[model samples]
Structure formats: structure tokens, C-alpha cells
Target: MMSKLLKNRYLILRRIVQITILALYFGANAYGWKVLVGNLSYSKFLQAIPLADPFTVLQMLAAGAVVGVDVLVGAVVIAVFYGLIGGRAFCSWVCPINMVTDLANWLRRKLKIDRDARRINISRRFRYWALGTLLVVSFVVGAAAYEFVNPIGFFVRGLLFSIGFGWTLILAIFLFDLLILKHGWCGYICPVGATYSLIGSKSLIRVEHNHLNCTNCGNCKEVCPEKQVLNPVIYRKSGFINGIECTNCGRCIEVCNDNALKFSIRSFLKNN
Candidate 1:
């Protein structure tokens, strides 16, 4: 067990962080912790500071800037956090839906399901279209209308309130990932993910591939939710993963037997 853990430290750490975040919200709701309130869309910290999704704020700005001061500040704080750390981290390390999707992926593999054979042939460009649609709908409705159908909202509300309808949506996501698509929601569909990727385009921390030790074994690609980002970087065609969509989830790092991949400031890696 100790040997297995030492090899997969980052994966274990990410799981812990995800669980703790959910637990905090549940505690605040059930026991009045008051340290953090609200879900991923908009949240209060210490009952004073704010942390919010910048994309949601963007929709609010588009519709009308008739929002609260705390909301704006919260969006900025979140933007900075993602900008420094890389945005897709939000998808893998923070989003509650990730837990469901990951489990689906694991189960699909275990059951010997053909991931590519079952997926719908939807354009990956749809995420951008969906992002645009979300903003337009918000502008038309004068509110963050997407939140009503947002799985993230459903997941959080289910945790705080009752599973009710949310469990249905959650189960659908699990099934979608398990049987219909591999990495369907986050990689191909989510507007929140698209927005965060845009915000973290020039993030400081990123995955750096040292081609010297790389073996071209493709273990990293097998595990990556965003494998497209790894090919250029790992093959030495690019200095590092430049794609904004790279989530910095560190799965590639943990699975790399050659120890060629690592997390570092993008500039430092390039300079050396």
C-alpha cells in the first residue's frame, strides 16, 4: 500500500481536496460553519470575502451590471486563482461532477467497454457554441439562466438539500461518461470549462515534458482527460503544453513511468 501510494501521490492528493471541498459546504449548511457559503457559481469566504466563477460574472455583465459588489470581487479572485494554477484544475480537482465522471471512466475500463465506439459524434466546437449560447440566454433572460440546468448546481444542491431531481441528472452524467462518451461533459460540452480554459490560457503553473527521458509509451495519454494537449509537448514539437484547455490535473505526471512530465512555472521550464 505504501509503495502504491508513493507512486500515485498527486492522484490521491487531488481526491482528498475534492472531498474536503464538498465536505466544507455540507458542514456549513448542516452545522453553520460560516467559513464558506454558497456553491461553485458564487461563494462567500469567512462570511466576508467572495469567490465566484468569472464566467457567471461575465454573463451578468453582458445582461446588466446590476449585480452586487461582492460578486464582482469574487469573480476577480477566482480568475486570479485559476490564472495562476491553470483552469482545468477546476474541472478535475474541484468540480463535484468530476467524481461521478471519473467513476464512470473507471467502470467503463473495468467492464472492457469500447469508449470510442459508443460516443455521439457531436462537434467539440459545440462547447464554444454552448458558451456563447449561455451568455446570450443570460442576456435575454437578465439572469444566469444556465444555472437552472447546470449539473454543478444540481450536484451541490443535492448535497445541501436532497438528491431529488439532481440524482437523475447525476446518474445520466455517469451513464454518459460510462457508456455513451469518454470524457463527454468536461472535454466536449461544458461552457464553464470553456470559460475557465480561456481565463487560464496564460497560467503560470503548467505541465512541462522533458523529452530527454520520455519513452513514447503513451501511458500519459491513456490517462489524460485532455490528451490532445500532451502530444505536442511530449513529442518535443512544443516546449510545453500550450493548449489553454489543458487542465493541469497531473494524471500524466502520476502515470509517467519515465518521469519526464512535471509541474512547473512555464517560463522556468522554457528557459532551462
Candidate 2:
């Protein structure tokens, strides 16, 4: 039953759309395409009539020109599409690097060597602290700091530089993902994930567990990539959400045989 639902047409379509967008993004970045369809650029083109490259927006935003039309437009698009639809849906399903990470995770699971289940003793509070530090650094040192830690940027650079030269460091991260980690870069590191997680907290769409129907079967916890759903702080709803680490990948929902979870949207103003 779980497998059938996981293989549902909607999920398959979602995955296809995500992969298509990610491929276009990679092509635009690597091949210097003037126009790409079904991506942020396409939407930007429709809005502005003369599409601005993402690099230009990145530069202007980095220089503290946040009030410009370009910045505003970009922010709205990112927030509405990526943040509101599903947190890090872009990262989980639409990122080329994330595709690679998923592939690695699959191999690790097949090998029975996955270590992502190991509980780290690090304070959950540290995620918030790290988020704060990234925001401050982005303001102070600029997007360069954020870019350095962004998996998207890292993957693009790795593809360009490391793939050609066969760099050991790049290969190591790839191998680490395949051997010891399950979306490790995403769950533990990836500043872009951190950024998206923050933006997505107040997003309209969110996952809700129907505790009344829940059997406490722990299936959701077992398959959750973020593993936060298992934490009492979040599971018990000690707060709106315990942390911003959730990617909203829907794997938990897919794994729950009891159909105890669902994603629904809420108005930000009304909820607040």
C-alpha cells in the first residue's frame, strides 16, 4: 500500500516537473542559454518582459540594493513558488545536487551502510544559531559567505572544476553521501537549505499529522529524512514547529500506511 501511494501519479508528475526545472537551471548556468522554460527565469521573463539573469539579481542583492524592482520581483517569485508550495521542494526534487545526493543515499541504503539514522548529540538550538549567523554573515560579508556554503553553487563549481580534474575533495563528498550519509549535505549542512527552511516557516503549505488517527506506528519517523517529526518537541507541537529544518519532502506522508498525515495550506496573516 505504501509503495503504491509512493508511486502515485501526482508524486511522479511532481518529480518529473522538478527534474525538468533542475535540468534547465543547470543548462542555463553551465551552457549560457539565453532562455530557459519552466524555471524561475521563465517566470521572471513573463513579469519583466526583459528577463534578468539570476547572477545579476545575486549581485544586486549582495550589494544591499534590496528595494529595487529586480530584487523585489525575485524575492516574491522565490517565496511564492519555492517557499509556499512545499519547503525546499526545489532543493529536494528540483536541485541537481540533491538528485546526486539522493542517488548516493540510495546506494548507501542498498549497501546497508547508511549512517543517517545515528542520532547526533548536537543541541537542536544550534540550528537556529547557525541560521542567525548565516543571516548576519550574508548582511555583513555579503552573499559570498552564503554562496560558499550553498550546495547549489558547490555542485555547479564541482561539475565544472572537479569533474574535469577529478578532484579528490569533490569525489570525497560524493562518496561520503553514498556511504555514510542520507542527504547529509542537505540535512546537516547546505546553507541554501537553511535559508529556504527559514523562508518556509510561515509558508502557506505545511504538513499536519492527524494525531487522532495516528496509531503511533512510528513509520513516519522511520522514513523521515529530517527526522524532526520524531522529536517530541515537534511531534507534540510544543511550538508551531520545533525547528526550521523540515524540507517538506512528503516522504513521511508516503510512508505512513495509516494515512495519518496530510499537507494543507494556511493563510499567514490569519494564522499569525
Candidate 3:
């Protein structure tokens, strides 16, 4: 049990972060708690500092909205924070949708769905295209178009505010990842994730690889959501997992019994 807990420490920590954020949101709404107010798109931290999602702000900008100074500050705060840390960390650590999709992924593994089912070969680059298309649509529609159908927004809002078909959208994503594609919504389609990936491309914190320690057991690749990022380092070379697509979820690090992978600060002087 101790060994199991140690192995899954990162996963457990991520869940705690994810759940704690949601609980704070729920508390703010239901009990008027001021610890963290507002939704993920925009929020006032501790009723003083503003925190905003930069991607949402971008959509507002694309839609020709007059974004307020505070909101802009909040967006900058978030962008800078993620730019220094891991950008898509939001997808794994803060997004409520992550729980649903993760459950679907777990079910996929438990049910042997990954082995028995036909795999889909969607290019990961499709997310970047989706991000671009969303901006274009936001410009043309005079609104943040993606916001209407965003599962993250829906799940968070539905949890704290109202249910109103949000569960259906969440369920669809769950099924999509479970049945259609592995890591489908997050890996292949979320423009929000795409935006974060771009912002955190040069983040300091990264999973570093020590090829000398690797056993080539493939445990890390089996659990990594972005396994392609490991290709250069898992068995081939020693360096930071530099792919912007990496969420820095630390699953690869946690699962590696060989100690080949661990989190480290990226070296600016060295080519990663």
C-alpha cells in the first residue's frame, strides 16, 4: 500500500488540486466563501487578486469585446504564471473536465478497451488548427464561440451553478475518450489546451529523462497521455521532455520504476 501510494503520488496530488479547486468554487457559490470566487475563465483570488484565463481573454479580444483592465491583469497574471510553470497544467490540474475524461480513460484500461478497440489516428496538430479556427470563428461570430460548447466551462459552471445539459456534454467527452479516441478532447481538440501549450512552451519545470537509467519496460509510455514527447528521451536520448503538448502531469515519472524520468527545471543555456 505504501509502495502503491508512493508510485501514484503525482496522480493523487493532481486529484487533490483538482478537487480542492472545485470545492472552493462550490463553497464560494453555495456558502458565499471568498477564498476563490468566480469561474475558471475569470476569478478573484481571495476577493482581492484577479485571476483570469488568458485563452478566454483572447477569445474576447478576437470577438472585439472591450476587456476590462482588471481582467487583462488577471489574464496576464495567469499567462505569466503558466508561462513559467507548465501551461497545460491547467488541463490536468484545474479543469473539472479532466476528472470525467480521466475516469473514462481508467475505464478504457480496466475494460481492455484500448486493446480490443480500433484506434483512431488523429494528428495531435489538429488541436493547434482548432485553436486557430476558434479565434477565426470568434472574430466572425462577434462572440467567444467556443465558450458556448466548452466542456470545462460547462462542467465547472454546472457543478457550481446549474446542471442544464452540461452533464450530457461531459458524458459525450467521456464516451469520446473511452470509445472513439484516447485522450481525444484534451489531446486532439481542445483549443484551450492548445493555447496553454503555446504559452508554456518554454516553461521552466519539465520532466527530464536519464536514458542510462531506463529499462525500456515501456511503463512510462503506456501511462503518458502525450507519449510522443517521450520518444526522443525514453530510449533514445537524455534531455527534458520539451514538447509543448506535454501537460507535465508527471504520470511518466510516477510510473517509472527505473528512475529514468523525473521533474527538473529546464536549462535555458542547454538545448533541450
- In order, the Cα lDDT scores of the candidates are 0.83, 0.57, 0.89
lDDT of 2 by residue, 54-124 (tens): 33244346547554575556656666665566665655655556666666776776777744455334443
Residue 89 error, candidate 2, Å: 2.7
Best by TM-score: 3
Using TM-score as the measure, what is the rank order of every candidate, best first? 3, 1, 2
Pairwise TM-score winner, candidates 1 and 2: 1
lDDT score, candidate 2? 0.57
**Residue 137, candidate 3: alpha-carbon lDDT:** 96
Task: Write down the TM-score for model 3.
Answer: 0.97
Which digits, one per residue and each the tens of the lDDT, describe model 3 over residues 48-141?
8999988889989999999899999999999998898775688888888888888998888888898878978889999989988989999999
**RMSDs, each prediction?**
2.1, 5.1, 1.0
Better of 2 and 3 by TM-score: 3
Per-residue lDDT, model 1, residue 121, is 79
Q: What is the TM-score of each candidate against the true structure?
A: 0.93, 0.69, 0.97
Residues forming the 10-long window of minimal summed lDDT in candidate 2: 37-46
How many backbone clashes does every candidate have?
A: 0, 0, 0
Off by over 4 Å in 2: 1-11, 26-72, 83-85, 114-143, 154-170, 180-182, 233-243, 267-272
